[model samples]
Target: MPKALLTIESLVKNYGGGAVLNGIDLTVYEGEVLVILGPSGCGKSTLLRCINALEPIQAGTISLNGEPIRRDSKDLPRLRQKVGMVFQSYELFPHLSVLDNITLSPRKAQRRPRQEAEAEALALLDRVGLKDRAGDYPRQLSGGQKQRVAIVRALIMHPEVLLFDEVTAALDPEMVREVLDVILDLARQGRTMLIVTHEMQFARAVADRVVLLDEGRIVEEAPPEEFFDHPKTERAQRFLNTLTFETVKKKAKNQ
Candidate 1:
């Protein structure tokens, strides 16, 4: 059996006065790609934010390697280093070059030698086909390139678990595949990742397991083949059907 790297139990999160995530129980195993699929406003993004302690929970616990993640604890900074997140916005510093944006945290926050940090950053950038763009500012790159840099920035932290929240959602149709290909490469390398995305074909291809969330709860969970080919719940069937319709419509328009 695979070891559980991150465990969430009875996880509850609230927004304003209502519960956005109600009694969620999930486990992310080491070296597995777990993809979360859901409709809009189903709390997929919130779940990731809560795991990163970017959002506070109303109840329950999130544990990494058996230790609770407390937002106010002094150890929080160290804990965060082990859980990297890449967002759709590509969160790179506008004024900094790609290399600076990626190396800053390691050089300043972790106190690694500047040379060592930049070396690792360049290697990661090269893997993502952006080594030549290292000297380029965020504004100089395309949407896909910026997103790849964001992934490189996250990987340079050497995090054990990576959270990707709709990482391809903001990209153009042509740019989407390049970013997804980079993530696919990471999955093949056995990186433990929790992804929230609407790219159905990519999800089916990359996920070891697929989790379907609805109304802030997991409605179905199964291996990718089983989940996509034989979803066991009505909610899951309907969700897939809607996406299938959308995909067909988009394809027809393109043709």
Candidate 2:
């Protein structure tokens, strides 16, 4: 069996008396690409936020390598570094260049030398096909380029796990492939990742496992092939049926 890297048990998150996450239990194994599939307002993004310690949980626990993660803990800053997150919004500093944005945390938080951090940032930029855009500000790049820079920023931290929350959702249809391709490459490299996305084809291609959520609870969990082709639960079946592939294809062709 693969070793469990991040574990969430009986996780409950409440906002103004209503539960956003209703007792979620999930275990992300080492080198696994786990894709979260659910309709909007199903708390998919909230779960990722809770794991990264960006939100407080009302009940249960989240652990990394057997160590519990608490929101109010003094070690939260350090613990958060172990779980890198890239949001839908690029979240890059507008005034900073791509290289600066990627190197900021490494130099300030990890205290790495300037020369070493820049070298690593440049190498990562090159890997994402953005080396030539290093000196450009976030606003100067296309949506896909900004997202790639955000991914590089997260990667420079060398996190044990990566959390991607609809990183391609805000991009143009033509640009979506670029961002998704970068994520697919990461999966090919055996990086442990938790991705929440609506791109069904990309999910099937990149995920080792697929998790279906409804009303903040896991409806089904299975390998990508099985989940996409042979979902056992009725909830899973309904969810899959709702995705109109023909319509999407027609729309794509029109674009």
Candidate 3:
């Protein structure tokens, strides 16, 4: 009840004859980390895209801090500045150095002075533990480092809400930890975040709420302990079972 930072009501997204997101509704409060978990192709990423207006919502409304982001609104550019997105692909410019990648948008999009934007970008890089890689290009950095740079780039916009679309999915097993560590740090700082992720451990450790999506619908949602321990829906139970079995089998092999 801290007054929702993000509100999605009756959200719908369709592609051709198939519905990618089916009448979804959810709210994210300030200073909370909300993890959206679901099987592949369940519209988790599409939902995030729709919220940020990267994908036009076929229907419903998405409001950030009480201002609605409708398809007809002329204020989308300003609205997008308040919502930052970090994708799984780490969509960095190969031609630019890490520092440039981080500062480019702020300098151009926000119309800030170059020096000011660079200073802010460096600070963000430092926060993400990438200060040493400032001059490195995307091709020179590891997957984890590139993703970190992407996060810093998004943060440079000073967004009010952050949307992460399975940021660790493409990272190597070892690299995933580094990215998750940074995300956990962000959560500790009370950043309002909505993440689509498969990492149940990260969700259990950092998320204030867990929303389970299945075939474009929210199947269940609750606190981590409640959702993981007592998943109510058949879809949630089956998903958890699959993950648990896979984890157990992997652990046994390792042992």
Candidate 4:
């Protein structure tokens, strides 16, 4: 059995007297890829942000390797180094070149030597087919290229667990596969990850286990094969129906 690398228990978050996440419980095992699926306003993005302390929790605890963490803790920065997140927006610094962008976190946040950070960043860029573009500014790269650099930026930190919050949601159709392929490559290498996305096809292709969330709670969790075909809850079934209908509409539009 795989060990649990990230653990969340009775997780809760509120927004202006309203609960966005209501008592959620989840565990991500080492080497596991968990894809969280939910409709709009279901708090999927909030959940990922909470883990990295980007969103403060109103209740419960998040732990990594069994040690509890909090937004107010002095160790937050140290804890965050092991948990990296990539957002839907490329969020790249427009003025920085790709090399500088990817190296910034390690060199500045972690205080690694510039030469050391650059070497690691270059290797990551090479893997993602962006080695030559290292000198190019964010404005000089395509949306896909900028996103690729964002992924490299997170990886350069050497995180233990990565969170992807709709990483491909901002990409064009043609660019989607490139980002997904990079994520798939990481998954195959046994990187533990939690992904929040509406891309059912990509989720099915990448998730070892899929979690269906509705109204801030997990309605079902199952292997991708099972979850896609045999969702256990009525809410999940309805959600799957919508996904299927959308897929059909997309295909019809293409033809």
lDDT of 4 at 79: 92
137-210 in candidate 4: lDDT tens per residue? 99998889889999999999899999999989888999999999999999999999999998899999999999
For residue 155, model 2's alpha carbon misses the true position, in angstroms, by 0.3
Candidate 2 structure quality by residue, lDDT tens digits, 1-255: 999999999999998888999999999999999999999999999999999888988899999999889988888878888999999998999989999999999999999999999999999999999999999999899999999999999999999999999999999999999999999999999999999999999999999999998888998999999998899999998899789667668888999
lDDT tens readout by residue for model 1, 5-85: 999999999998988999899999999999999999999999999999999898999999998997877889889999999
What overall lDDT, based on C-alpha atoms, would model 4 receive against the true structure? 0.92
Clashing pairs in 2: none
lDDT of 3 by residue, 155-217 (tens): 889899999999999999999999999999999889999999999999999899999999899
Backbone Cα, N, C clashes tallied per candidate:
0, 0, 0, 0
lDDT of each: 0.94, 0.95, 0.92, 0.92
In what order do the candidates fall by lDDT, top score first? 2, 1, 4, 3
> What's the residue-level lDDT of 198 in candidate 3?
93
Quote model 4's TM-score.
0.95
User: What C-alpha lDDT, on a 0 to 100 scale, does residue 53 get in candidate 2?
Assistant: 84
Instruction: State which candidate has the highest lDDT.
Output: 2
